[model samples]
Target: MNEPIISVSGLRGVVGGSLAPDVAMRYVAAFSAVAPAGAIVVARDSRPSGRMLASAVHATLCALGRPALDAGVAPTPTVGVLVRRLGAAGGIQISASHNPPEYNGLKLFGPQGRLLTAAEGEQVLAQYRHSGPAWVPYDRLGGWQEIEDPLGPHLDAVLSVVDAGLIRSRHFHVVLDANHGAGGALGRRLLEALGCRVTLLGEAADGQFEHPPEPTAENLAGVGAAVASAAADVGFCLDPDADRLAVIDEAGRYVGEEYTLALCVAHVLADRRGPVVTNCSSSRMTADLAQRFGVPLVRSAVGEANVVSAMVQCGAVFGGEGNGGPIDPRVGLVRDSFVGMAHILAAMARRGLPVSRLVEELPRYEIVKTKMTLQRHRVPAALDALEAHFSGARADRLDGLRLDWPDRWLLVRPSNTEPIVRAVAEAKTRHQAQELCDQAAQVIAALG
Candidate 1:
């Protein structure tokens, strides 16, 4: 039997092969057994498989004597909010993130509307292995309910963080590409509320993607051209689940996802100075902003849960990942694309500068990423060889092998699921960044 790839926060796998109804039910039962007895909020993206999985999740929760509160199709972050708002025991989001359509997964949240910590996640895993849910008596089975306006409160909370009035007055022309995901539901409302003359692409919530769903520069070529042709001020593209976001400048240049967090941090820090947190893989521009504002910046491992954990520990006002996941403490702990959009628009409106100019004003850096195949057992030897080759560079094993230079850095780590060593570098120029990755790959290859 195929097994799902379960992690601390949730599980993900290819549909039909590894992610069948039976496997999903078992995990749901495990989660229900461990969670406090209360209504559990459930939401999903616009994936074709989401409806089927949602039904399965509901059945499992009901059978375990836990009421299921369905939020229907919504972003992952929205599910987190509804969980807190309705006082649910926890929440489940059905999304594979930026993975292909063939892949789908479930993300679990705690009662406080946060993803489970490492300790809490271990408890759920143990329950899954043990395989016994404390089912209530036949007369005490949990009930089910549906929520019609899950996005309303989320929209209000996001708008409160930014100057909606100012953004509306600017009358900016905006282009939004939802790619037929759940984002279209709220993305349209947020844009309209901001009073922008909006042109939407792939607005249907049908899970039919016009292009690849990741929102990377290469995949956003059509969005770039649409921005230029529409003569809009900027373009926004969201992944299949809407948890991640990428931007295109007014000039039709893909500014990339790395700037999503940096741009929002710059805006927030300009008004209020406070601590910021991000994963180790985030760009150095975020660090530069913290330095300019004299605010502390903390780094965590490369994951939303890690970043959120550090943010709470450090009392950070803002935190996110370089992959377009911006987490605003005011909104929720999860990375929210809607918050990023609202903040960027508010910043542009206040400064009265074009999106292109605003991007140019910030510190710039280039990042190059590459991966190499290696057996899992050989990772230790590869790390030793890499450290020896780059003897002059400062070495740190916070998450993996990280070599730091005065103005550049390279991170060599193994993929969580694949048998490949991932290498990432950031430098002052694109060539320099690529060179760093190439040098690391060459050193690792020589060891093999």
Candidate 2:
């Protein structure tokens, strides 16, 4: 069997190929070995393979004499909420997020309802490598229990943070493209509670995708037309686990995942100003939003766990990635698509502006991303050459090689799972951003 992409957070790969039942069992055993001794909450998305993988996970937990609280067909954030709400030792969400249907994986959360920190993840990885599952006698085997209302706590948590009444008063019409992910049920309920007339697409929790599954501009080709025809005020698109969201404007324009965080930060900082945190790879428009609110903006290494760590360290009021996954401590520590939806609705209601106008008012930026294949031995020289070429720009090695200018920036990062280097550049205009990437590409090509 091929190896899955294993990390401290969890592992993901092709369902029956790289990721198999035994792999999930050993991974869960590793988590259970390190996790505090208490009942664990296990939730999953609507993926078809989730059921089979979840059975293996449950069996492993039971063999370890660890109780399992099965939260069937729930989103990733919901697992976090459930873990904390149930006071469990930890949580495991069987999801591949936005990956295609043939893929599946597990995301582990600590007892505090957050992704495991780097230190914690390291211990789990070590445990998985050296020690195997500690199976117990039948008499000592733990049992599983199905959760009755898996979505309730998460819904209440998301609704409580935003001005629900204000959003309801607006009577906004919304088009939610759940894309047959685990979040469809909760997405529909939350939208209706906010008094929005919802036009739900692929709301089933069956892992059957109507689109390419990733909620990107290119993938969500026809969704905007549906929003326009429904005469909806806005459109919301969610990935498989519903942890990430992408937006569509009132004009049926794809506002994209990057603006999801910026718009939320814009609305949140206005209500309660505090430090903001985002990954290094996120758009700089959020930094401008933080400045507009006179709050500090801190950028951490690229990853959701790293962003959460920075948020906790800084006590950030709002933080998220450019991938439409917003983390609001007011809701829960996990990247929450529901919270993003609510806050965006609140922003629209409070500003009394169309989504398009709100997006227009924000600072403009274009980020272009491209990658090149190179041997691992050549990565350093390529990075050095790019850094030397862009000598005038400020450099930061926080996550990768990032070159910063007054109004433009460039990032060249090697992929964690591939023998490739990705170059991302952002500027005032698409032409400028593309030019930056082009320049970096030329420098990297020189190393060849």
Candidate 3:
């Protein structure tokens, strides 16, 4: 039997291979066993498999006599917002994030409308592994309800964070590439509300992806070219789940995902002076921005849940990961593409400059990411060896072995979603970053 990749947050795998209808039902049953008592909200991206999985989730919830609030075909962040707005006990989003079309998965949210923390997720996983479905009697079965106007509340929340009137007056010509995900619906609404002349791509929520699902530099080349060809002031690209965003300048430059967080931090710090947070894997641009405002910047382990956990602990004003995900506690805890888009437009309007110019104002660095396979048991020894090898640099063992220099840093950590150890390095020069990764990889290889 094929086993699905399960984590504290949720599970993802190829549909028939590991994520079958039974698997979905069983996971939802496990979730129902532990979720807070009340209604549970359900949402999904544009994946073709979403409907099937949604049905399984709904059935499982009904069997457990838990009300299922269905928010049909919405972004992942929308589920988070609805969980809070409707006072639901929990929420489940059916999305594989930026994975290829063949992949689909579930992301669990707690009552606070945020992804489950490591502890909370572990509880659910434990229940999932041990408990069988407790089917309620026929008369006690739960009912289903549809969420009408699902995007309105989320739209209002996003618009409130930016200078809507100022952005409206600028009438910036913008390009949005939703890539046939749930984002296009709200992306169009948000952009139009900000008074931009919008050129939308893949506006339908049919799950037919036009390009690679991930919004990386290589995947966004066509999007950048489209931005240049459209003669727009800027372009925004969203993953299939619309939780992440990538930027494309008017000159067809792919700004990548790191700038999404830095640019938003810059805008937020301009008005509010408070603590900021990001995962360790994020670029240092946000750190520089926080320093410019004389506010503290904190780094958590690499994951949205980890970042949100630290943000809550530190009372952060804004926080997010580097992969085009920005979390504003004001809107919601989930990583929101809409929040990133609105803040970016607000930054552009506030600076009265092109997207590229705004990006140039931030401290610049080159980051290289590489990964290698290693048995789990050997990870600690490898980290110890690395720490000794780079003994001269500042060492941190928060999530992994992180060695930092005055102008560069390297993080070698195991992946939460895969079996490989990911090595990420950032420096003033690309060569330096690549060299660090190469050295680390060699060390791990020799240890193996």
How much does each candidate deviate from the true structure in C-alpha RMSD?
1.3, 1.0, 0.9
Flag clash pairs in model 1: none
Residue range 377-403, candidate 3, lDDT tens digits: 788999999999999999999998889
The digit string of per-residue lDDT tens for model 2 on 1-448 reads: 8899988799999987999999999999999999998999998899999999989999999999999999999999999998888899999999988888999999999998999998999999999999978889989999899999999999999999988999999999999999888988999999999999999999888888999999988998799999998899999999999999999998789999999999999999988989999998889999999988899999999889999999999999999999999999977899999999999999999999999999998999999999988777788888888888989999999988999999999999988889998888999999999999888888877775
Per-prediction TM-score = 0.97, 0.98, 0.99
Model 1: which ten-residue window has the lowest total lDDT? 131-140
Error at 211, model 2, angstroms: 0.5
Clashes of each: 0, 0, 0
- Candidate lDDT values, in order: 0.91, 0.92, 0.93
TM-score of 3: 0.99
Cα displacement (angstroms), candidate 2, residue 326, comes to 0.8
The residue ranges of model 2 lying beyond 4 angstroms of the native Cα positions read: none
Tens-place lDDT digits, model 1, residues 104-141 = 99999999888888878989999888777666678877
